[model samples]
Target: MNDSREQYTLANGRTSINALPKVSLHDHLDGGLRPATILELADSIGFEVPASDAASLGEWFEDSADSGSLVDYLATFDITVGVMQTTEGLTRVAREFVQDLAADGVVYGEVRWAPEQHVAKGLTLDQTVEAVQQGIEQGIDDARGEGKTLRVGQLVTAMRHADRGLEIAELAVRHRERGVVGFDIAGAELGFPAGNQRAAFDYLAQNFLPVTVHAGEADGLDSIRGALFDGRALRLGHGVRLAEDIRIESSDDENTFVSIGGLAQWVKDREIALELSPSSNLQTGAIAAWGDDLQDHPFDLLYQLGFTVTVNTDNRLMSNTSLSRELSLLSDAFGYDLEDFEVFQLNAANASFLPLDERQDLADTIIAGFQSA
Candidate 1:
């Protein structure tokens, strides 16, 4: 169940995917907790878990999430989030989260989680953010001690179903100098449009804080439009459904003619990054409109048509996946090579919430790593 330790390679088996430097843009903090940690934390708090052992717990997560619905997939978080209601729980989870990312060859990552969800134990929003930051710093040092370069930032998220959007936005901006990098709104993406949180988006915009919205996953084109026009998202979380705007006019043996809708055209022209998680998309039924298999994913179509598509493991524990495993699955599905893998990593690096100079530095590091490989 420890997917980070697994080795992955390109379709030709000439290069190792795990050896390359990578950037993760859409990883969820609460969704990536280790099963053993959950067990110990839950025991300390006298909370009940679905499984007694680590292996069974891991399997249960994967199996439950495979129900092919976003709501059903997210229901598994009740256990993981239940254990993260204390300072020790939050810090330890965040620390191990980074360690796991480093072990998976992630040079840089942005961990997203809702602060309000973790304050159930009477911790203030600021306290929750501080605890997670403490863990992130510790995790960075831990990875450094292991001789792996790692940098992580928190994306303080507000549950879309809640009325604390503006409060969470301020919390994110309040901790910008610490470990927080950006802001996000995630939850049920169907009824909760980004427009409902317009006040928070306006606040973030005025403060010049970057944003990424969980859109185009459980909903269609209008949801994406609201994310762009209202939330002012610098990136789209699981923007897989944006493919709906594209009309496949015709296709032949070698040529596939297509027409892009105005919205898709704007997104393409603006180069908005699509934080696409292949496994999570399938597990959440986000890509069910296209097909049931990985090959049915529109990632290749988006990439070939020049959309800014980035690979991510939206929820590693839920999907029983890692960045390397996701890349390997995509390679298997579409004959991708090391060069294509490098492109995906570079795309993620550029789309990250880091400053432009640091993003370029990350891009250079990725290039150097790929060249060495």
Candidate 2:
């Protein structure tokens, strides 16, 4: 269990909301490695870590990630990926990632990671996926042993900063029958447009594979446009920048009139899920155009405007957060209670890459858990 995932609750005086079932759609597998696990993995490889002990190393990650720039914040991934090169390291880290999520009460999760980053230790791309899958299976059984039931899917991600999109996409499709569920383009989102990976997106479309693109996080609407149009992304990784298209025409105390641009209207009407990570958004300056705090995030506006908004922790270790903590912060910032949190979970359940029947099952599980809560 990740002791860092302390119990959290809504301000409405409910019991531990952390104990309530949740879904994670945009979490990263490589980005959620435990500090102690990294230390152990690095030691076996004779690799040097920034901090000596787990406690200090965890603090170093948290401090380094608060740079308020997505590019700078992503620099911390070097250490996490450094330790995750071998099959054993990948499997162990993935196992612990699921265990941590299960401990935090996540019933369902889709973990995304770029396989290209893990080949340094002579493991083939397919071998890396299999390793992580083995760990996920182990984690599930371990969680069940401790009376905590959880399900996880792998979203094979291609780094947008690199040129292996089509190769990685093919890898994801090859592993679909094994354990993979979806495909994603991650890493630096700006400059590296989804259009750069047109071949990969086209191949995925031909194969009818599900895709979710990292857009509107470090970039603007054009990137999101490419994600939807060029990449045919089923969901936006962090489409908070879609708010840029919303024109607040007039406002008053009682109500406010607004006009959403064609793109914003399209996303809202199409019910595209905005996988918004509140603290990460603020830390990485994804919401800097609005303000510098959670209250300033377009999440509230997007949620109020009827856009499909779902809470997530994009990188639990880098952001030092979990789905539970994200919900607590959102609740505090927006005065949300259990009902609002339930709505977010329902939105995520509907937007999940799971099949119709499985999505319905997840929704049922979420509803039942929230009711029990």
Give per-residue CA lDDT, model 1, range 1-373, as digits (tens): 9578799888668788888899999999999988899899999999999999999999999999999899999999999999999999999999999999998999999999999999899999999999999999999999899999979999999999999999999999999999899999999999999999999999999999999999999999999999999999989999999999998865567676799999999999998999999999999999999999999999999999999999999999999999999999998899888888889989989999999999999999999999999
How high is each candidate's TM-score?
0.98, 0.97
Cα lDDT tens digits, model 2, 1-373, are 3343688877766668888889999999877988888889899999999998998998899899998899999999999998888889999998999999899999999999999999997999999999999999999999999999889999999999898999999999999998899999988898999999999999999998899999999999999999999999989999989999998865566576889999999999999999999988988999999999899999999999899999999988888888888998888899988889999999999999999999999999999998998
Clashing pairs in 1: none
| TM-score, cand. 2 vs. native | 0.97
Q: What value does the lDDT take at residue 334 in candidate 2?
A: 90
Give candidate 2's error at residue 289 in angstroms: 0.3
